[model samples]
Target: MTGNRFVTQALGEYTLAGLANCSAEIVKTARPVNLNLFSIKWPVTALVSIAHRISGVLLFLAMPLLLYLFELSLSSEAGFRRAGAMLASPMPRLVGWLLAVALLYHLIAGCRHLLMDMGFGETWRGGKAGARTVIAISVLGAILAGILLW
Candidate 1:
């Protein structure tokens, strides 16, 4: 009923639960828990999530450089040759390779996140394994990209 105190209190508690980053135990006991994201004791799942965020940011930052290169390569024969020469340099090659690695990592991590949303890797063990798998695939893809780039 609109005048029910218990219903209002329950709704408030649920809203607070959704807002806080506390664990289930903290929620059940209604106690505040101090969490440090930079702690060394973070699990693989946390590491994977952090890496995913980092890679996404890296990709965002690289977009401008990629677009500039694309424009240079498409403008004219001289512009295309200049773009090729720039890419042939060591520093540009390294940066391109790193961006490629970031893309691969982001893509694989995205797939993992999608699977997680579909109810896969929802358990503790599954989450850990999925993190490891994502890391492994990213490393392999980066190495392969490096080889191909050079």
Candidate 2:
């Protein structure tokens, strides 16, 4: 049989062929739709998961700036002084603090994920508690990072 005829004959053999046609409409109505992000009340576990993803993006975006600074500092004596001065500025210090905090949070969240993979904190209650602990540790780390950065 030709490809189209074969497909048609196979589809004619099952109820799923009819379902395939209406699948889009069925999916649209079968699931709960919430497009407004602000209107939803997010749980701690969800928030932490989102934050973990965002921190990963932030870290990826920061790589170029960090690499440039590293290259500049190693180029020459003058370049090293320039890099140091740039870091000493308020904006660079703030960026450094943010980077540090993001790193700390990402690290803690990653550890949580690793533990979950190992079958720890896989339950709803345990996951929530783990998320809260991650946030608490991140906050404390952020404060310490700010203190040390400035």
Candidate 3:
């Protein structure tokens, strides 16, 4: 029966008994959330979340280009050579590196999310640490991809 204290207060002319449980119900006024894109500094966890979403979208949009390249490389010998030559150029190489980096980041972030969903790294400190680890690994993988691309 241990619970909140009942504080009786006056409302009008009638004297009420101790019936109001003010301590039981704590209400906080909600503040208006400002979502100005450039006004707020995001934390590491938020940055990782945003990058995860962006990387996923980038991979989805690059699917058509990847499919086209696959089809071109398999169509004919000349087409295969053309595809190879196209990939050899600087612009295409850069784009390929970017796609590779995005894919790596998305994959790592997805694994982190899965682990969190499975009850791992569920605490606030653990979540932030996991996010930092994901970012560090993704950056290292991206650097290796860039080195390979060049």
- Candidate with top lDDT is 2
Which prediction has more favorable lDDT, 1 or 3? 1
Count the clashes in each prediction.
Answer: 0, 0, 0
Q: Write the per-residue lDDT of candidate 2 for residues 35-146, one digit (tens) a residue.
A: 3445444667778988999999999999999899999999999999999888788988889888889999999999999998898988777888999999999999999888
Q: Which pairs, if any, clash in model 2?
A: none
TM-score of each: 0.73, 0.74, 0.73
Question: How do the candidates rank by TM-score, highest first?
Answer: 2, 3, 1
Per TM-score, the best of the predicted structures is 2
User: lDDT tens digits, residues 69-127, model 3?
Assistant: 99999999998999888878899989998999999999999999899889888676777
TM-score of 2: 0.74
Task: Determine which window of 10 residues in candidate 2 has minimal summed lDDT.
Answer: 1-10
lDDT of 1 by residue, 30-144 (tens): 6435433343245577678778889899999888998999999999999999998987889999998888888888899899889988999877778789989999998899889
**Candidate 2 residue runs with Cα over 4 Å from true position:** 1-30, 33-35
